[model samples]
Target: MGGESRIHNFGAGPAVLPLEVVTEVAESLPNMNDSGFGLMEVSHRSPAFQEVIDSAMGRMRRLLSVPDDYEVLFLQGGASTQFYMTALNLLSNGGAADFLVTGIWAKKALAEANRIGDGAAAWDDSSNGFKSVPGDGDYSVRDDAEYLHYTSNNTLFGTQFNHLPDSNGKPRVVDASSDICGAHLDVSKHDLIYAGAQKNLGPSGVTVVILSPWAASRGKEGLPTMLDYQTHISKGSMFNTPNTYGIFVLDKVLSWVERNGGLDGAIRRNQKKSGLIYDMLDGSDFWRPHAEVGSRSMMNVTWRLADEGLEDVFLSEAMDSGMGGLKGHRSVGGIRASLYNGCPVESVEALASFMAEFESRHG
Candidate 1:
């Protein structure tokens, strides 16, 4: 605790939580609402917990400006479960789904859909080492496909679709786990949007699913009750003992987001944080960023040291200096600084200053 102020957390997911939220939760754990019991002791079916669950869903819809046509369900599994649920519900509708493989998550989603029914096209961009967005030109989609699936942000590769792909005539489905709440989305553009709450919303237990009524109607009939969107929507995301703690924290975070400026506010602050780091990468010869111009993610900034040999030394020193979780995914094998909503701008500025010092000493 002595050196806590000296450290900053930059982990991808299950990352930094707001100190205010943590403090409030810490205080409440002793005796919530003077009820002589903590939140952990409350019954999931009780009205107290139902209010918590309802408020979380309400905040989600308002903060994201989800349209009335959409149903927002906070499910138990992470976005990974959505990979299969999407296929089980949609792809099983007796038609294939078009998949645009932009990053690791998209590929995984497509693979799951393929297992259940049929994936119209692979759309492999692997030969490029996943550096750039897959070009939308000339690629054809099936007219009868259930839906077109894509991942909006590639967390591992540090690439983001700054512009959501124009779906042409197909229904758009997105895995937005990493970049969901970071900006204002034209929700009308996509029929379905799913994201795990761990990154920007709150914690790791809940996955947010927003589906247009028409898309929800397309879900296959007779699937397992839990995997069905209609089932979760009807239960108000309270079907089977929802993740109470996660939903409680998420509701608080949404309130925080609204007070701070909603999606536009998030976009402005994120740009500032990401810009600080991107500027340093561009100016410093010692640092090379993996994301191409116009395609960079404002959430996760992935970069490499000039020499791979220097990576370990840089990481070790960064850790010693009290900077946390700067290491990128092992698949990508570089440094990734994740600047989620909870991450203070001060953290990125401090990291940039350290990078500058490192470059000066090495040069």
Candidate 2:
């Protein structure tokens, strides 16, 4: 399929998947493991489905190097559900939370927490035009706060926190939806890490939650059964009907990552791919990158043409040439090329070449 098409995907979330992984899923969905029925028709209590979930969790642990202390949960809904769940579980006894406001998603998370009666402080970084990370001075981390929340990578802004900030003694919680499996990290520092599987793991609908058992044990009561983390964890994520198809695809993608080089291998490839694009952006003044240099994201590379009018021209020609998804978020009007793990190095090269040709003609 890569050979037959000139198109390369660069959307922020619900982004690209390995073409090989997609083909494998397509072949397996109809009759997974040669079972009499399709995966969708398989019962959750059945041994076949148990094997599926077990294998999926095992692969996740191996790929991410998840510790025994952390429980890998395949939960319903995307990262958005995590906003309320995190607040409900962590602040159950009643305490404030702190969030470093970097982009739309962080703001949304804080807003959700506020609605749940958890007071949240948005760390001030507006002075830098939202292009840089927040300093210690920008926030007053409360000793009474249950946890400190932040998005590891801002997909919309093209900014990322390569290293999570040290919060003294507070537990760190991260919504790594855009850059989770694409890199390696010390998961011990975080109380909980949740990422939707759509971007690099698999298709949309299911979200992966990795939590310290202590964090999992504090889930609040009085919530609906479906929203309770304890309920899902106890049921082995098979309570009621599951998003079997999404889990199936996730299993395949995990296999792909394992074969290609686990977490370290993924980080190496991502760094290499984004480095090529960043080098091009830095060398030519014809294009100006939006995010602060040091904080720029390896997953989402956003930039703008020197002349604003060239934006439309670039988008039109790139799509015509079969290189698309380069248009940035409407809120930030520019171009964003999301280089998720599944996206090959060759795609990045195609995009760079397209940019050079377009600029040469228009410059």
Candidate 3:
């Protein structure tokens, strides 16, 4: 779908992608790089796919400013797998890790860590209905913790850590699934960063994992081959038939980012797009944003109508107005507009106008 057929896509994941990137992928689908092998049917061991993976990795490293020593892998199974995989490799021998349970994903990350070792929450916002991310002073990491784990952005509640949480000098491991490339990130500060590519990078089934030297070399003595980072790293991210098409599309997307001014451009666009919606939310008491002012997410802007019963009406009107994916997550039960890297500023303006029109009619 292109041009008029495309509506404002704000679905959480398997989300919107750049039209340029999508067009390139679609063109490559039949015969990639003139290799005669379709993108989906190409062998992972082939030279064409090798070039694709290498380019994807190089672009990610440059875009994120990842340390030279850090290992970048394009793995399968999304960010959810890394929840247990991170713990399996980092905490397998038995050690404590502290977590900032900002939202559902962080809670799940910590719970998975506990199964492998001792994972405890240093601070959690669940009791507060996850309205904000905790300030460093609000939480205390364990003295003996191996590392500090946190989800950089809470997709469900639209809360994000504007500043890095104080890890108390421990290595930081983050699940940055929802807001990886679109948000401001210091890859060097964190020992490990794992993100599912669907949100901003490209499509689902491809995960970007960046690991520091320590994390790369910290594999346990007898980790299961598939779950172990070393296993994939040793084979150069080809432990199994990698996500061939996903990686190719990722490379194209990253190339698009490079042409569009890389990470800085993405950050600026995300801020601008989200700022428009936030301005509307803040100006009107008719709309109530879910996250605290200081902790709002630029990628996922979530909110409720002042009259809760109007939410369904709001979503319906949004769809009728040529907007799609305005529905909230089932659990969150409100509207969530995901302004990932791929989301355009024009879409936000359209939404803001729609909101104003709706409020004037319904308010």
lDDT score of model 2? 0.83
For residue 135, model 3's alpha carbon misses the true position, in angstroms, by 1.0
Assess each prediction's global lDDT (C-alpha) against the native. 0.83, 0.83, 0.91
lDDT by residue (1-363, candidate 2, tens digit) is: 344663688777687788887777666767887876686777777788788889999998877778987888898878999988887777754568888888888888888888665657557454565676665555667787778898888888888887767665788889988888896567888888999888878889989998887788877767788887888888888877888888888888888888997888899999999998898899888998989887889999999988988899888898888777889998788899999988999889988998878878988
Candidate 1 regions with alpha-carbon error over 4 angstroms: 1-6, 33-35
Of candidate 3, the 10-residue stretch with the lowest lDDT total is 1-10
Greater lDDT among 1 and 3 belongs to 3
Q: Which one wins on lDDT?
A: 3
RMSD of 2: 1.7
**TM-score: which is higher, 1 or 3?**
3
State in Å the error of residue 309, model 3.
Answer: 1.0
Q: What's every prediction's RMSD, in angstroms?
A: 1.8, 1.7, 1.0
Model 3 agreement with the true structure over 195-257: per-residue lDDT tens digits? 999999999999999999989988978778999999988999998988888899889988998
The candidate that achieves the highest TM-score relative to the unseen native structure: 3
Over 1-363, each residue of candidate 1 has an lDDT whose tens digit, in order, gives: 233574699999987777777676667676655656687777778777777787888888887778987989888889999998988876654468888787888888987887788785536667777777766673667777768888888889888887767556878999989888886577778888999989888889889889987778876668889888888878877778888888888888887888888888888999999999999999968888998887788989999888988988888888987798999899888799999988888888989998888888774
lDDT of 1 at 261: 81
Error of 1 at 138 (Å): 5.8
Ten-residue segment with the worst summed lDDT in candidate 2?
Answer: 121-130
* TM of each candidate vs. truth: 0.95, 0.95, 0.98
